[model samples]
Target: MTDVVATTPGLFPLPDWAKEDLSDLKGHQKGDLVSGGEGGEIARAYDRVRNEVVDDQTDAGLDRFVEGQARWDDMLAHPLTVHENVETGGIVRYYDNNNFYRDPRVTGELTFSGDVAAELEAASGLLGSDADDRLQAVLPGPYTLADLASDEYYGDEAEFLAAVSEFLAGEVEAFPAHATLFLLEPSFVTNAPDDDLDERASEAIDAVAGATDADVVVHTYWEAFAEKPYAHLMDADVDALGFDFVAADREANLECINEYGTKGDVALGLVDGQNTLVEEPGTIAERVNWVREQVPGQEFDTTYVSYNTEPFYLPTSKHVEKLSAIAEAARLAATEGVEA
Candidate 1:
C-alpha cells in the first residue's frame, strides 16, 4: 500500500496571493532573490483565477492558460526584469536576464538556480513532506529548454541541446536526495521526431535515474501524447510517464493506453485544471476504474488523476485549497478498487 503513488495536476497558475509583478527587481542583486509588492500582485492574480475555477464549476479549459501567456511574453522579452526584492528588506533586484533554456550568455545549467530553487522550496513547503508524495517537479527538460532557447542562445541547436542534457542530468541527480519523484517535463519533444528527441532525452533521463536513488517519472503536456513526436515518449523511460487524458485526442489516447499499458507507470490527467468546470469526484473515480479494467494485471502500476494541465493563476486562494481537496479525494477514490 505504501508503494501506491499519485500526483496533482502540474503547473497550477500562481495564486493572486502568490503572484508578483516582478518588474521592480530589474537590476539590483546578483545571486538569488525573492521580492514582494508586484510579486504579491502576481500571486494574487493566480489566487483569483484558482478561486473562480473552483467556484464556477464550468469547463474553463486551456483558455485560462492564456492569461499567464501574456505575462510570459513580457518575461521572455526581458528575462532580466525584476519586481520587488525580499532578501534585502523588499529591495528591487534584476535577474541576469538569462533564459532558463540554453542561453549562451546564460549558462545552460539544469541544477536549481537561485530564484527557481526558492520557488520550488516554497511549493514544497506548501505540500510539506507530501512534496515527495507522488511528487513530480515540472522543471523544463534540458532538451526542450535548448530547443526553445536555440538560435536565441546558441548557434547550433544540437550542441546546445547536448549541453542542456548534461545540465538536466545534474538537476535529476539532485532530486532523489530531496524530493519523492523527479518529473522531468519535455513539453517541446512533441514538435520533433522521436529519434531526434529520444537520444538527448534518454541521455538526460538515464543520467537522472542513475544519479538518484528515488523513483523518477518523466512527463509532457500541452499537446497530444500520440500525435507527432509524443508517441515516442511512451517508449522512453519505461518506469514513469504522465499523459493528458482529457486534452490528448481520444483516439490517440486509446492507442497510448494500449501501447504503454504493459510497461510504464501511467498518470492520467482526467481533471480539468485548465477549465473552470469542477469535475465530480464520482466522474474521476469512474475514469480511474476504466483504466484499471483496460489493463487488468499489474501490467504497470497504479493510475492517478491529475489536472489536465496546471491551473491558471487567476483563481483565488480558496480556489487552490479546493483543488488540493479535489486531488486528495481523487486519490482516495482511485485506490478503492485497485490493489495498492
Candidate 2:
C-alpha cells in the first residue's frame, strides 16, 4: 500500500506567545534576542514558542511535523533578512496575499551567514523525543529566494543565483539525516524563468538537495502553473513534487500534470489553509480519489497530503484544525484504499 502521508510545509503564523514581550522573559538575557545568543533566556523563550508548535503538531496526529518557524521574523527571507550586508527597504507584497515583506538588497558577496542551521538543529532537538520520527523542514527555495531579493553584488543573474544556491546548499547539508526537506517555491507559478535561468534553477536545486541523504520535496503554490508549460519543474531533481489543489484550479493543474507526468511522488495540497472552514475528511478523501483517477498507471510510492500553502494567514486555532484535517484526510483516503 502506498503511504499517503500528511505533513506541514512549515512557516506557521507567529503564535500568541511570540507577540508577547520576550525581553523580560524569565530565564534569559534581554540582549539575547538581539544578538541571537544560543544559551540565553531569550533563546529559551524562543524554544518555548517553537516547542508549543511542535506539541500542537503532535497533537494533530500528523505523520510528519514542521518546526512552525516562529523565529523567522522576516517570513521567507528570514535570517538572511537580518544579515548585516543586506539592506531592507520599503514593504513589498509577499506572494499574492495581503501580507508584505521588507525588500532585501544584497550589498555584498552573499554568504550563508544566517543561523538557519541553528534553527533547524534546535527544532530537531525539540521534536526528537516528543514527535513522530518524520520531522519535515521547510526552506525558501533558491530561485525564489534570489527572485525575492535585489542583487547588487553579482552583476550576472546566473552568478547571483548560483551564490544563493550554494548558500542554501550549506544549510541543506547541515540538516539531520532523518529529516525531510521541503523547498518552498511559490514564485514558480508566477515568475516562470527563461531556459538558461530555468536550467540554472534546476541545477541549483540539485546542488542543495543532492548534498543531503534526506528526502527532498519541491513545493509550489499560489494557484496553478502559468501559461508556460513549466518544463523547468518537470526537470527538477527531487524525491517529491507538491502542487496547490485547494486554492488552485485543481482540474486544470491535474490535467496538465497528467499530460506532463512527474518523476517524484505527488504531494497534493488538500486541506484549505487560508479559509476558517475546516474541510471534512470524507470530502478530502473524494478529492484524493479524484486525483488517482486523473493519472493512470502512475506509481507514486509516497503520496504526501498537505495544506495548499503555509497557514500563516489563518488564526492559530484554525491552523491547528487545518493540520488535523490533513492527517484525517489522508487517513480516510488510505482506509478507502486506492484502486490501481
Candidate 3:
C-alpha cells in the first residue's frame, strides 16, 4: 500500500568532518597512547550524539544519548539531524542509571518504534523531489541482527533464527505506514552454515513480510549470491532483491536476476556506498546500462542505481549527505535513460 515508483537505489560519500568526531569520541571512551586504554573509533563515534544533551554529572555520554531518544522526533524534524550521525553500527541504545528508558540500536525491533519510523519518514521527505523516485528504508534483517548478537540469547542456531524471525516480524509490522519497502539487510547470511542459511534467511524474510504491511526486501552484500549459500535467499517472499555489485560477482547477480526474472524488483547496487570518493556519475550510469543489456528488454529504466554498501568510511550523518548525492545522480541517470 506504500507509494511505489521506479527509482534507483544508492548513497553519497562520507564527509571528512565525521572522522574527527569519530576520533574524538573514541579517544574519550578508551583513552589514548598517552594513557593506557582500548583504542578504536567506537568511543568517538559514540560521542557525536552523546555529548549533545546530557549533563556533566551523568555518564554525560550515555545521558546525552537517552536525552536524544526522548526528543528523537524533534531532532529528526530537520531535513537531517545535524547533531545525529547516520552510522548504524555502534551502541544500540542509552539507558538511565537503573537501565530504564533505554535508546535501542538500529539493528533490532527497536528501529521499528514510532520515533525511528518518523526519522525514516523524515529522511525520505528530505529528499524533496527525489522522494517520488525509488528510495529505500534500510533495516537490519532478522538473520543479520540475530547472528550479530551474542549467542547467549538463543539456545542454538535453529532457535536463534526462529526467535529472530519472530522479533523482526513485530518490527516489520511497526514501520511507518507510508514507506514503500523495508530493505532488510542480512549481511551474515554469507557466514552461516550452508544447510541452514537459506531456510533461516527465507523464514526471516517471510516473518517480516507477514508481520508488516510494507514490502519486504532481502538485501545482501560482500558475498557471492550465485553460490548455494545465497540461493536460499531466493526462497524469501521478497518484493525485490538488492545485491552489492561493487564487490559481488556481477555474473552471479545477473544469473540470479535472470532466474528470478520479474518476480519482483531488482535493486542493482552499482555505486560503492562504503567508500568516501564522490564517484563519477557517468561511470555509474554506464554500468547500469551494461546491466540493462544483460537483462535485455528489461530497459535501463527498470534498473535502479545504488551503492553496494553503506558509507562506513565516516560518521553516519556525513555518510547520509554523501548518500544523498548518489541518489541524485542515479535519479538523473534513470530519468535520462528512460527518456532516451
**Predicted model with the maximum lDDT:** 2
Please identify which of the two predictions, 2 or 3, would achieve the higher lDDT against the true structure.
2
Best by TM-score: 2
- Global lDDT for candidate 3? 0.46
TM-score of each: 0.65, 0.90, 0.61
Better of 1 and 2 by lDDT: 2
- What TM-score, to 2 decimals, does candidate 2 have? 0.90
Q: Model 3 misses residue 260 by how many Å?
A: 4.8
lDDT of 3 by residue, 149-231 (tens): 43342357677667656755664455444334544363543554457566776677677777655545566676656555456
Q: How many pairs in model 1 have backbone atoms within 3 A of each other, for residues 3 or more apart or on separate chains, i.e. clashes?
A: 55
Off by over 4 Å in 2: 22-41, 129-132, 226-229, 337-340
List ranges where model 1 is wrong by over 4 Å.
Answer: 1-6, 17-115, 121-136, 152-154, 182-189, 227-235, 260-262, 296-298, 317-322, 335-340
Q: In order, how many clashes per candidate?
A: 55, 1, 17
In candidate 2, list every pair of residues with a backbone clash: 28-41
- Per-residue CA lDDT of model 1 for 1-340, tens digit only, reads 3222334534444444323433344442322232465445555443354344333322221111111222332222112222121111222211222213113233333333333334344444443454453234444455445444423334565565666556555655444224334343535435543666555655655554554555555555555554434444444553666666676665565565565443446666676655565666566767666656665544555444566555543254444543554555455554655332
lDDT of 3 at 306: 54
